[model samples]
Target chain A: MSGGRDRGPDRGRRRGHSLHAFRAILAKDLRVELRTLQSVPAMALFGVTTFVLFRYGLDRTKLSGGLAAGVLLATVLFAAILAINRLFVAERDEGGFDAIRLAPVDGTALGGAKAAALIVYLVVLEAITLPVFALFFLDSWAGLAPVAGVLALADVGLAATGVLVSAIAANSRARDLLVPLVLLPLLIPVMIAAANAAEPLLAAQGPAYGGIGKWVGVLALYDMTFIAVGFAVYDFLLED
Target chain B: MKVPSLRALSIATILCLGAGFTLVFFYAPLDADQGFVQKIFYLHVPLAICSLAGFMIAGVHAIRHLRSGDPVHDARSYVSIHLSVIFGVGVLLTGSIWAHASWGRWWVWDEPTLVSFLIVFLLYATYYPLRYAIEDRDRQARYASVFAITAGAFVPLNFLAVRMAQSLVHPRVFATTSGGLPGSMLFTFLVCLAGMALLWTCLVCFELAAKSASAKLSRLRRALEGETYAAPNRSRIAPSVPSRAASPLT
Candidate 1:
């Protein structure tokens, strides 16, 4: 059955709210995650630890330009991968996919829900990590706001890709290893665009908008492509 | 369902390869810029183009596989990617040799084309392990198709991202202007490209034919040997060709 968007008078009366299904699934995930305190806190802790490691590894008191962007975005992306790996675990082990298949709602709801949930985790990730990164390295908070904007765009793409990849790996034997192995290469463009966009913003001189537009455009393109892809292929990936 | 016979394809391949090589070394004029070393372009560029093309072809086949649930399409898709990865190895080696010859380094991050190709290669490289990690044959084919399609879509976008990140800092190694390639060099490059494309197609056919034969042989063995016969390897990653005599699930 087509998702709620295409239902008509002749098509059927039993069709409405793929949106409702998406919301319910997303709410369930968020509630479970909140109650258990599983993913975000660990990801936040990982982010703080990574920033500490970067401080020692780069051996710089303050950071800017490519270095700051690399350290910050890479940390967020890796932490996103952590969340991504576990995204479909409960579904796989607990027959959530069967529930989705049995429901009247469209299968894309699961992917949409998962991507929405992952984006939430990423936003929370940036919230915790950005302040710590600023305290540890940034001389001014001026660049932080723009970096967050670039990161938000990157997160959409990451979430779309992460959901699709997580679904694929979730059924496999080595789900943990397969997630990063398959995901990191896919995330390279995100890294390239996000890091480039953030670089000028993170410049040692202070925030600059110069050339940020191009990278943002790239991030937007990457997000649109993956979202469209995940939406189109979600049904097939969820098939019995 | 029908393919050109192996003899015809091999003959065509040999002829094109021979003529392409001859034209590259003899007929094509020396580059005014890089000179002798530029000849590697005929080899490297074609290999890169064919390899990328093969990947997109695999994606197309994957789309059909997902839609039709045909293991034949999956087999075709698998062989296309398998051959492309092999060709990718050639692309990297030739590209590296060219880089070394021209830039005096085996690897350079500055060249966006090289870097993009490496990223594409790296992404597709995971196809094997992804297939191996899934034990169920049908699920493996299904997931592998998803990977192929996603990675295929990624190729052009990855190039765009890598190119934008570099911002044309790469020394234009090919031609300064869009149509600037001289007629003679263009002719030779076309020949080599055609040859490489033929070689790729020929390899795909060879691999598919080999896989089909082996699948048929196994099916025959099971029929003759009956219940006592065991599959040689239950954990094989490659898709077993679904011949008309055999059910796809088998």
Candidate 2:
């Protein structure tokens, strides 16, 4: 009776894909990470350096650099592109993608792991970029709070969307050029939101970029919309 | 398999196109504000809306193809979206000219209608590169269909995003929040919208015929190639798309 139940389609669950399969994918990716340890450090170094250049580029320093914060989400986003551009390349290059697809892994689960890994990678970079900018330019406590929140939210959306694109690029020819070209245009809106919302915070002006309520709502909407899309579409993308 | 004829459609299109313009010139009262040139709104706004509708149809077919995996639906959808791009180009041109005429500038960074179309233009322009990159017939269809479906998000997101970015310069004369258009203007606007929509249908049907024919021709050509497919072509055709066609435009 136990064997029959365990082997049943119902017990197998949802077209034979299992949560264990999802967990296995997460574990597989982590094991791979433990072996290489290359991507995270490269992404972190690139993200930190890019953030510093922008904050340092400003002349008048304090107030001016603050104003630049909201707008320079584009720069951080470019750093994201650089970091994750090779995301699925390793899977394709080593011919491991096929084995993974054949491993009973749900596409969403696999995408979730990669996205989780990328977010972890990007957040480390952000951990470097944001603090360096904070010590150098961001001074006020009130301003710092919202700016940090918005930036964190913006990075999630960027990474999720970027991961899907990176998959498409990795599969195609002239992949390196293709990824960034497609990515940067899509990144423009998030850059707009991040910049506009963070502007007042940077400048210590009244937070009136459509009010904090409207501004953060846009970022949240963007995050939910893209993450859902990335998860659903990643299956089709990853299925060879 | 079957599509409706364009006969009555085009006749109605021509008649209404004439009638729509006539009302714009003769019937609608002059604005209490901008005088003669304001009449361009009758033509400009409807055309933009018509193109937006075209984009929406393309997006719908894109989703249908992705879900159902039917090549026929994919062809139809690709046709609808292709026509949308053609119509969208027209919208940008006419609207920009009118903008230049009124505002003394060809482009405004803060205009909702203008910038929104710019984003749409950029988005659809990439559609070609997307098509060229993938080799699978059905996968190409699937990817394109999904991209098109996802584009609906861009239309609204761009519109809303642009509005949030700055104080919009484009007039909201038609917006209900701005008290709506006067009755005569409203009537002319609706007629114009109907006329443009009819014209769009005709164009989409035309392009649908062209695409379906082209696809059949390519399949027939491949079949004619007969032996070996040059040996390399068979495997190459399965996955690696023609590299040049797939490159990003910049």
Candidate 3:
């Protein structure tokens, strides 16, 4: 560990090394997830099943433009909800929150770490779902690249919001129901931007990059705002 | 200085709203485009603006509650959101009426403002359930404040994103044919806006007073009878007013 490498300044700065705490939490979550196979696989499987349901429900062999964007975004959003609903369960069950509070580290680290973990889960879910979406509904792959950018920004927004909401719902009585009820409305703007941006790229003729930048900018703004807010208010949520 | 009594504010709200309605019907000229249907605009827009403002005010109160650790701020935040959600119903109903009268549809997704309000209303409607699901009083207040702040920030961004999504395809429907509001319409709109704002304030004050009175009565009952007479009930979704109900304004 780097704890002993710099003994002088590091000793004085130990409490402020929230980054170290954040990394430890993130690593712990990732390790547990890897071993348990808890969230990612379920999200990916849910995404695939939703795509199949869309095929049967919409009664379309293939989809394009706004319809395609809506279907894909909604599917991915539900999958994200599946992941988010479970994000804080381990912490609540195992008394991880008390441990975090007792440690000499910034409380926001838990929020940051949880958000990062959710982002990782989302990325993995997308890796599996995007290909299936293309194979099932997309007429061309040209738009997929730009759509990836939209997805990334949207994922950050989703993770930041999901982690905060999950934390709030964790100690509540109806934890499972409270998460989705509170989370969906908060994610509407992200879904709006992602769907609008993807609509052009997923057009039947070919991908168009014309208006994608504006929507991506909206997504980025939403991400930054929620991340800052989550960071600022998370400590209040943690205080016993 | 003494705060203006709730009775005074309620009377002022009545006068302003009455005068605003008269101006809408008799003073302002009918629009060349939509004629009588456009009248709903006077009611709809003001309600929308007031409701959104109420949500933001709740957010401010939530910030205070979180910072000061005061239950009064939480009560204020809860009441503000409660009133705003009621106003939100007005916005949606009036909006639907306008849509039906203008476009022959009961609901129109093409109107970005209405759609955005719908999204926001749905979001805030969950606030009660969220509060109910939390059993601890203090924790519920804190979490509700967090929700309020987050949802408040979401209001403008949601409007912007929804507007952008619609702008590329649909021309905005609520604008006057003259490209800018004429003097008479603008005056009438301003009056209605003021009236709605006043009504919102009056209702918030009334609710606060009612809640304060209820809390004091409960305290009095406990004082005269005993603790067992006013036993602590099961947790409620509404925020509990602290026993210090002396300052309803806070």
Candidate 4:
């Protein structure tokens, strides 16, 4: 970080640096993740564990309709925290993050690629969990759609934030515990959408004239707001 | 960038307090709904708006830092955010007390007002940890700026999201429910907003003065440390900084 020489040419080299940097980071995370497949399995395990808990405690015998929405939202939220914690920490433990930062590159684009990989992993984790959640807890697909949209958009905000926090966690004590301490409080926006959207949809209320639209709007606003914030901050977090 | 003198700010504080209290106690009419409890609106809304405004200033300075690579601007922006977090808590405590008075509940998730304050509380709470977890000064400033800006958007959106949800636990007949208001309430609200902004301007100047003084103190201390500390001209940074203490908040 301290020793690099600043060369004369400004225009061409900087562009090439950005492109190369993005690809390098993307490839590195992908290869490491593909070989070990750590995030997916740990996330899947978390999803399964949540489902098992839901199934064991309230699997129809003890459950009521009013509590269904609240329970499902809690389920997705638990999966999210597990997935985020697993996905971010492993990148540093494997030295993938250090390589990306040490490389001469556009840190934001590198951050962009990391976000992309994270989103892909998250989507797959969600997929694995969806059937499990649907089979055990939720009634149908309608509720899952809005809830999924909320999770997806929230995923970007979380993962973009994950990049910043992951960097901080790397240099801190017990990075694992620190991630959630910093990350969970930021979940207020997510909590509102997931809980609200889940309740109406689980009751099969999606057919209303424009009911789901409001929840969708909430999710979209969260996405747009955080994406802009992430872009502005990514470069700074990468200054090494 | 303009700063009111400390004496002037002190005078302004006295005037705003006198006007705010007089208006609330005597001039403002009792609400058709929540009664005098609604008067809490005079304090809660203005504090929330001011804190949000502070966060926005931090975001703007973050832009300057990212664009021009100016650490001083980064420091100034962080100072604004620091005050914002403190004021944001003031907003939360007032809102919570108002909720207890009006709704007969200390905390409820569905009330947009309660939910909004919780969001403000939680988001700003994250700022300190984010600052403390990092070893890099510039990185802390930058990430905290991103957080400060995101907070600007998140605060309002969270308010809206909680409101849009079905079966709200807290309902208010405040101006937000209806677009505009009676002339007097609107006038009172505007005066409060302007007063709070002025208060923030004064706070920022004070913080900057303290920060500059502290920076000078650190430099002087290092200079006196002599052979133990490297000279500033030749030292680009405190290289390989270990056992160094960082601020709890960025």
Candidate 5:
């Protein structure tokens, strides 16, 4: 299989550097997402519906402090899971994974590209959902700024883990069920840090800034750790 | 490969456990705070530590499996996580008993270690399902290793996050009670920890031996009766022994 490409000149050319491949894959995913409107819009809609459910579920028109933080975090988390579940469906159904495997480009690029795409979906989901969340529950908007920072860091951690897990689940027999079952437990630390950070920011008194830095540090640590792990293990995962 | 001396290990485990229990009940002084109920701590904490160590050790074996492409390492990793999960159940049960005795409740989120342990247990409990969801054996083993490594790394971070979340409110329950332990209590605790570690090792070896024996029996049956007598296995949750390791006669 490697005979034709064993020549020196063709080797470098065939094994095109990962940056180009990464960008190509990321752009392709974005274009498909844009044209299809498959994941982001549905996730946004889910977020809004969940918020309304929480409104009646909690039986409170207004929410603040830990309750508001918990509801908002949980809503975003479930929405992210929806997008994550769909992240690799196209690649699996269509022959995207096989194509990437055949290519000489590094396999980690697929992980990187998929993670980048998931991050975009999360950002868009937050954009649509956070405003609705604030209007529905928050007494004031003072907390929104710091909470956005926390959410953004949390999004990175979510993207790193979601992309890796989505790839693993996509190839499994019970792909749909396996994604959520395995992913939720892995996400507890992220949820813990995000909720803890957002709790004070969404407080009833007027948005305290205390300890946001520590929680953000934890989020960043989790993000970096999983991103490195996903990159290191991506090659092993790709082997037939 | 030569099998380790399971008999000696079992004897050591029994002796250490017996001595540890004697120290707990007879020699060590009762806690001024928790009184007789504090005895459960010696059991719960050691099991908790051993289980966590077992998980990290599984991650190490998984790394070896991936690097060497050796199914023996995979078998070792699987058995380690299996034993750890069993120990995790013990930790949760004993922990619940301690919580009920002290706080009058079966479960409490305020106890960071117990809560973190519950989360860890929930995470590892999915390992069997994850393994079963993959149809291919080689792929199943590889994916399971990846899961083990990821979950292993998550253990410490999960504990840290949970501890941080609870730090502000919960007054470090374990620390306050065991901070300045008397010399006898400390010695007894150390002995119990050693005993629990030995028990974990003995159980892992015992399970591995049983699996190896079953694999060898199947191999013998295949050799004697040809292909027709060998039936396909229906259950996918149990990790398979590498064929080479299973057949000593070969």
Candidate 6:
């Protein structure tokens, strides 16, 4: 994005630089996150704490099937909501939107970067919290691999939809409240797909991968749909 | 580019709905399984279909609004969603009644269609807060359009996901009701569906026309009574349609 600084009347030619702009924004977001540690640590802590709460709330030290999947995904989803709400705060507060508007770079680069950044946050969050959940609840780690797969697909969908919603809610009053209210309903499909897919894998006896393909397909469809919609509409959202 | 007059639309709505209810009671055969309670199906199914269609139509209008930067399209989009949400209320109420009658429960998470409708309704119900949260008129409309389009796309996917999540224990409602409806039942259902669709359209027209009149009245007040003469109780969240003499709503 900084390379746009010297462009003049030939700025229209810079349209080809969206990928570079996307990378720059992604790098900047990562660098800021690494320095400040605002989102990931909080999300990880929230996820872990949620597991502890669920352990007590459900009164189940050893969960399996749909109950286990529900407990795990619900924690992950709410934590992701925390990350999503914070995704666009820096831009909103520091005049980053004006900077993007003035830059010759494509506006959608911001959305792409934010989503990528969210996916990173979710991955790091899952990495930390999923282990804690397993240690606290599960008797075996055999299903962890496919459970991770479900979580991975769900993270992509969540990130895409989250970033899109974050952009919208970031500009409104009571934005914090708006994000979850508008977003939770939207994320139901993701929850359904992920939970159902993870259930059989999280079964009490052993992990079974049956019927996982279709749910994975649903998650993939959800990711692509939101990513495309977010890309298409981010231009309008940023148009002041 | 003229819309039917509100009175004419209202008449159509009444005629269709009246004929539909009459057909439901007088013509359609009683269900072998669910005798009288099955009648709610005629009302609930049509409302659900119309409400879902209205949401998708709002998405189309939202697309046009974004492309044209026209408040008229935004108005249409808003009214479409707004009226559909009202229809959604009817859907839920009647659906609950049907469920209570059939399953002996007021609600059933096992039923994919009912659950999915609830999800869609909850999502669109947030539209009001989303619009009110944004103080900027132009920004509010634009963001709401973005939301409308996103939620519209979500409707079908939600149904698919929820349906897949349904367990095998609860047989599908249609399957239980029998795979095919008899001729008389199907005819009655078609009339009710048409009636509900017309009612939705009439409501949209009614809302848009009311909004247009309010806009025009405010514009006239501004012109005659000076800029400082602000009307009390003017809604802050409602998108104000530009008062053009030849507006399609008029």
TM-score of each: 0.95, 0.84, 0.93, 0.80, 0.93, 0.94
Candidate 3's TM-score on the B chain: 0.91
The DockQ value obtained for model 1 is: 0.85
- Candidate 4 lDDT, tens digit per residue, B1-250? 2234555775786688668667777887887877888888888888888887777777777677667766666666676777888888788788888878877877766666666666667767766666666566665555566566656666677677767763656544364756546667767777777777778767766666655555566677788896687544421221111111112113
Q: Using TM-score as the measure, what is the rank order of every candidate, best first? A: 1, 6, 5, 3, 2, 4
Q: Which candidate is the best by DockQ?
A: 6
Which runs of model 5 end up more than 4 angstroms from their true locations? Answer: A1-16, B1-4, B168-179, B232-234, B243-250
Query: Model 2, residue A114: what's the lDDT?
Result: 69
Query: Per-residue lDDT tens digits of candidate 2, residues A22-59?
Result: 66656766677669876666765666666566556755
Q: In terms of lDDT, which candidate is stronger, 1 or 2?
A: 1
DockQ for candidate 2: 0.43
Classify candidate 5 by CAPRI docking class. high
Per-residue lDDT of model 5, residues A76-148, tens digit only: 9999999889888888899888988998888898889999999999999998899999998888999998888
lDDT of 6 by residue, A57-120 (tens): 8888899999999999999999999999999999999999999989877789899899999998
Worst 10 residues of 1 chain A by lDDT: A9-18
Relative to the unseen true structure, what is the C-alpha lDDT of residue B137 in candidate 5, on a scale of 0 to 100?
Answer: 83
List the pairs of residues colliding in candidate 4: none
Candidate 5 residue-wise lDDT, B1-250, digit = tens? 4354667778999999999999999999998988999999889989999999999999988888888888877888888899999999999999999889888999988888889999999999988888888988888888888888888889999998999888443334346655677788889999999999999888887777778777777878889999788555736767767544432210
**Chain B TM-score, all predictions listed:** 0.91, 0.81, 0.91, 0.77, 0.90, 0.92
Ranking by DockQ: 6, 1, 5, 3, 4, 2
Off by over 4 Å in 3: A1-15, B1-4, B168-179, B231-235, B242-250
Point out the higher-scoring one by TM-score: 2 or 3.
3
Docking class of 2: acceptable
lDDT (10s digit) by residue, model 6, range B164-198? 88865333445645647777888888999999988
Clash counts for all predictions: 0, 1, 0, 0, 0, 0
**DockQ of all predictions against the true structure, Cα-based:** 0.85, 0.43, 0.83, 0.52, 0.84, 0.86
Runs in model 2 lying further than 4 Å from the true structure: A1-18, A27-37, A48-60, A63-66, A139-142, A205-210, B1-4, B177-179, B214-250
